[model samples]
Target: MGSLRESLNRFNKQQEKCQSTLTSIAASAAGSKASNRTTTTPAPRAVPASTLSKSPVPAVKFSNDTERLQHINNVRKSPVGAQIKKVIDLLFESRQSFTAEQINEACYVDVKGNKAVFESLAKNPKVNYDGKRFSYKSKHNVRDQKELLKLIRTFPEGIAVADLKDAYPTVMDDLQALKAGRQIWLLSNFDSQEEIAYPNDPRVPIKVDDELKQLFRSIELPRDMLDIERDLQKNGMKPATNTAKRRVMAQNGNILNKPKQKKKKKTEISKRTKLTNAHLPELFRNLNG
Candidate 1:
């Protein structure tokens, strides 16, 4: 009798599951018929992030293609959707931010409507706004590994990683991937965190006095460098790191200057000179003057 009671309980659960399945199917079928009968546009359904997940292959399950197109038309007719579409189209044309005025002109929407859509959509995680302009947030717009490397080279003091993440959330994984590969470095001090992609470590910006800048005008070798550094240290000077040395070179506006090639001394050749003249070009002889 106990075994029979257990079997009955199992059957009741199975019956409930079957009823739930039938209810879902019937609801879907009824939705299809309602979509076919309705001529008016229904409210736009918000597509969930789960629905947008990338799939390897496309699958179309419903026969609601006509209804879908009509819904799309309704979205286009709606002010908010139309404005968002304008922003998308503008981004496709130019990834640069579009000003409210520019969008109003191009999309032919009134200023008030444009402002409303911009303010609303600006809250979206994927929409980017700069107080006055709008753009679609994209990873490509953010500094990639190569660009971060370039930034490392440019700003030797290092870039705040948090600031970079704020600018490009999409590239967070890319940045982490590069970090994992040891292609870049994440560093921190007492107050801040930064990324350094260049091989040379970045140093804090320091003001170099003219005398020190003159001393490091050209790179000094170990002996001269040690002597100069020792002498400067006696005067309470900080030893110049590579970044400091570069800053000095840049302050003088010649960091990018190529080393001056030694000019061959042109000796001036006398028109009436003999072998005693030690023949050389007249220009060479005149170089001493």
Candidate 2:
């Protein structure tokens, strides 16, 4: 009975040891699985440093109220109109809508404080205002070459470039192509250099008569401007003062003080010349007289 009890105790001790070993293996596997899960899960992406920071706003400085007022006047008088108009124009060109505050920040102009300006813009025929944002209301929506050409043709004289400001960004490109194709004429003002677009008109060819051609060929253009001036003066027409001619004459020589040629005495020539037969005849005739 003692031997049997000892054997049973030994068997129980072996079973407990095996159970502990299995538990340890299971624990280790669970720990490895947890570690793998932690390693496999991705970390959150880092945000860019540039996106976190905002750009600096530009400041307009004035020395006095008078200068500030003058600047405001100048801004109002500009072809684009006041600060609000400029903001609207910018939005139109960009083809994007923006709030007044966003526009102020983007354009570097503070129009939020000026209620009058906003009122004027809201009332403007070329601008559209939503409850939150402002957009451009195009007078003529010229998107492509065909539309541009059609609009240009509507104006017989010519269409001002400023009038087509609401057109697409590719309007200039279309204009250039049309100009190259001789489908349109782009003329600029002499004083302002402001571009104007004119449609190419194809009219019936006028055949010049031979007599008319001959008459045109026979007509002579005046070559001498002095004759023209003299004729104009004789006809009671006062000639325009030729400043360019005066300047040229002044540059060539002084017109006021002209040096006169010194006249030589007859006796002065007698000393330089040898006595000839011609001189002897004149001397004898003078002596006889």
Top-lDDT structure, candidate number: 2
Models, CA RMSD each: 32.9, 20.4
TM-score of each: 0.26, 0.38
**88-205 per-residue lDDT for model 2 (tens digits):** 7787788878888887667644556666777777888878788778777777887789999999999989988877866777878888999999888899977679999988865634
Q: Output the lDDT of residue 165, model 2.
A: 62
Q: Show pairs that collide, candidate 2.
A: none
lDDT of 2 at 65: 75
Model 1 off-target regions past 4 Å? 1-133, 136-143, 192-289
lDDT of 1 by residue, 30-52 (tens): 99989887856677889998779
